[model samples]
Each structure stands twice: as C-alpha cells, then as structure tokens.
Target: MANRTAMIDVGGGFRAIYGAGVMDRMMEDHVHVDHCYGVSAGSANMVSYISGQHGRSHTFYTQYAFRKEYASFDSYIKNHNYANLDYVYGTLSNHDGENPVDYEAFEKNPTGFTVVACNADDGSTKYFDKSDVSYDNFDIMKASSAVPVACEPYVIDGVPYYDGGIADPIPVQKAIDDGYDRIVVILTRPKDTVREQKKDIGPATILKRTHPEAAEKLMNRYQTYNDEVALAKEYEKDGRVLILAPESMYGLNTLSKSFEGLERMYRAGYAAAAAIPAFLGS
Candidate 1:
C-alpha cells in the first residue's frame, strides 16, 4: 500500500468551507490517509477529516460560519481581533459532548495527526502532533488558526503562536520529509491563478506601519506558497503528488460571507475531488 498523506493548505476564513467538501468526498470514496497535515483554517478541516466527522465540518461552514459573532467587527474594535476566540473555542469543544472527536484514534493513525503553528516571538514554525503532551489538540488547533491581527495569538506554555500559514502555507515539503510515498494536496484557489503583486495599501499599509513583524510574516507566507506550488508541480510529474483545486472560485475570497458563494465553493471542491481518478484507486 502506498504511504499516502493529505496536505491541506490554509484557506482564508470561510473559504475553508471548500476543504470540507473535498474531505467529505475523499471519505465517501474511502480514500485511506496515513498522515494528515494542515495549517490555519485548514487545521480545523484536518481534525474533521481525521475524525471522520466531515458532516460536522460541513455544518460548521453552512450553519455557523455566517454568525455575526463569529467574526465580529465589534470584537475587533475592542480586542483588536475580529475572530471571537471564546466563541470558536466553545464551538469546537463540543460542549454538548455529542459526537466528540476521537483523539484516541490519532494513536492508531499511521503517521498520526499534525498541525502547524508559527511562534510569534521568534517567527519560527512549530509543529504540534497528537502524540505531544506539551499541548492538547485544542491548543494546537487554536494556535494554528490564530491569524495574526485577525485573531489573537494563542499562548501555550507562556509562549504565543500565530497562524502556521505565516511560516509554511502548504507544507508539501514537510510531508515529503516525512517519507510519504504519495501526497494529495487540497488547494482553495485555482491552480493557475497568479497572486497579485500590487503594492501594500489600506489594511496592509496599516499592518506594515504598526506590526512590521506580522507584515514580514505575511510576506514570507506568500513567498512560501509560491515556492511550494512550484515544488508540487515538479513532484506531480513523477506521480508523487496530486493537487486538487477549483478551476475558478468566482468572486469569492477569503472573507466572503455570502451563502451562495460558500455553497458554490463547496460544490466545486466536491466535484474536483470526485473527478480525480487517483482517488478512485486510493
């Protein structure tokens, strides 16, 4: 059997709804994953995929994503963070105790589950695994999803960490280093889309002036994403990597809250996954 790994990229905000559809289709097709890696919003999707709760992930986007409190401007005004960490934590905690994630299954998983976060102080990447006792799954997930100014850094053992995408967006290199024979990457954007090279303006201008370090990290993330895209293409030739991306995302962006747009992205993701012939065999 091939040692298969899934590398889910950091989809911006509700754009991660697309990843849910990809995961759901993969599960429905019975694609076996030996290892899983994710950063930022992708970490949430990773948890759902590994736990076989893609339905819950779907509900999260379709039902809970549009809540005014989820990404409240009021929270941003008061706390300097648009993301309501408390609300996010409560939702993921499964407070009702119904259909809790099977953390124990991580032990049985081949290469186990891994989430990446960026150390805020040193600007270094941190990889947290289920086997690591230093931080629990929630800590890892929260830290990984903490998107700089959009979401406050999560403190673990007195050290703060932000979104893993700041350091490594799509960690195809990490999966390659881990000895996965084949890797399947789920991308939120179209494969051929070119990143805009416009000068920093508006919020980016403010970020650079106030939080230069955060600005630098964002730049690094962009460079890393481009580099990984090149690497993925090179690996694709050898059948070592397969990438699934939407042909187009219409006008939907990371922060789009339109229900119609979110639904379109979700369906596109599902169709992309289903169209991959490799998945049928896997």
Candidate 2:
C-alpha cells in the first residue's frame, strides 16, 4: 500500500467550506489517508478528517459557520479582530455542544496528523504534531487558524502564533519530506489562479508598520502559494502529486458569508473529488 497523504491549503473564512465536501467524498471513496497536513481554516477541517467523523465538518460549515457571534464587530473593537477568538476556540474545544471535534479519536488514530502555525515573534513556521503535548489539540487548531489582525494571535507556552498560511500555505514540501509516496493537494482557488498584489491600509497595514519582519513574512505568502503549486506540478508527471482545485469560484471569496455561496462551494468540492484518480489503490 502506498503511503498516501492529503495536504489541505488555507481557504480562509467560509471558503474552507469546500474542503468539507472534498473530505466527505474521500471518505465515501474509502481513500486511505496515511497522513494529513493542514493550515489556517484548513486546520479545522483537518481535525474533523482525522477524527473519522463523517459529515461533522459539513455540519459545522453549513449549520454553524454563519452565526454572527463567530464574527463580532464589538469583538473587533475590543480585541482588534472581528473573529470572536474565544467563541471559535470554545467551539473547536467542543465546549459549545456543536459537533465537537473528537480529539480522543485523533490521538488514538494511527494516521499521522500535523497542524502548521506561524511564529509571531520570528515569522517562522511551526509544525505541531501529535507528539507536541505541550498544548491541547484545539489550541493548535486555533493557532493555525488565527488570522493576523482579523484575529488575535494564539499564545502557546508563552510564544504567540498566527495563521500557518502566512509561512506555508500549501505545505506540499512538508508532505514530501514526510516520505509520503503520493500526495493529494486540496486547493481553494482554481488552478493557475495566482493572487494579485493589493495595497491594504487596514489593521494589517498597522501591523506592517509595527512589525516589519512578520509583515514581510505575510507579504511573501503569495509567492509561497505559487511556489508550492509549481513544486506540486513538477511532481505531477511522475504521479507523485495530484492537485485538486475548484473549477470556478462562482464569486465566492474568503469573506463571503452567504449560505448560498457556501453551499455552492461545498458542492463544487464534492464534484471535484470525482477527479481523484486511482493513485492510491484501494
């Protein structure tokens, strides 16, 4: 059996709803994932996947994601972030009674799982695996999903960490380095769709002025996304890497909150999974 792995990229906000569909289809197809890597919003989905919880991710995205409490303007004023970090943290911690993440299952599963987060102090990448027992699994997930400025950094062991996407969005190299014989990549955007540079004068702008090094790391993530795609493509010819991306965004973006858009993205992801070749034999 090939050591197959899935590397889910940061989809941001509701865009990550799509990944739930992909995971659902993979489960239906009985794709044996030996390992998983996820960053940013992808980290949340990764937890559900590792837990072997069928339809739990889908339920969270469709039924629970739009609650206004998750994104509160009052919280933004008080915490410099619209995301109710506490609420999100509690949800991931399974404290709110919503489809709670099965952390016990995650710990017992033989499949390897790794969540990536960005170091706030040095702008470096941090990989948290099951062996990293210093922090709870939900805390690692929260840290991996913490968007700079949009959400406050999550501090673990006295060190602050932000979105893993800031340092490594796709993290294909990490999967390769882990000795996965074949890698399946799940991307939120369409293939070849590189992000265009834009000037932002929001809280992020303030971050740039205050912490140039960390801001530089954030700015370079665009190139990192592209570079990771290129690396995956280079390996495609030999059948080592398979990339899955949405055929069209359908006007859905990272911040889109419409239920219709979320449903569409989820369906798109389920449909895209039909393209998964028999690279990992059943």
Best by lDDT: 2
Per TM-score, the best of the predicted structures is 2
RMSD in Å for model 1: 2.8
Worst 10 residues of 2 by lDDT: 195-204
Which regions of candidate 1 fall more than 4 Å away from where they truly are? 95-111, 132-137, 197-212, 275-282
Across 1-282, the per-residue lDDT of candidate 2 in tens digits comes to 545655555656677878878888877887657788878778777777777887887776676657766765776787766776556657544634555667677778787778888888889899998676322436787788787777778888898888887788888888888787677788888888986446333545666765665677777777777888888888777788888887777667665567787788899888877766476642
TM-score of each: 0.87, 0.91
- The lDDT of each candidate is 0.71, 0.74
Question: lDDT by residue for model 1 over 1-282, one digit each (tens)?
Answer: 644555555665777778888888877887666777877777777777776766777777777667766677887887766876556645444434333555555345564677888887767889988665221337777788887667777888898887887778788888888887577777788887655525323344555664566567765566677788788888877777888887777567665567887888888888877654564235
Candidate 1 local Cα displacement, residue 77, angstroms = 2.7
lDDT of 1: 0.71
Candidate 2 accuracy as lDDT: 0.74
Per-model RMSD to reference = 2.8, 2.3
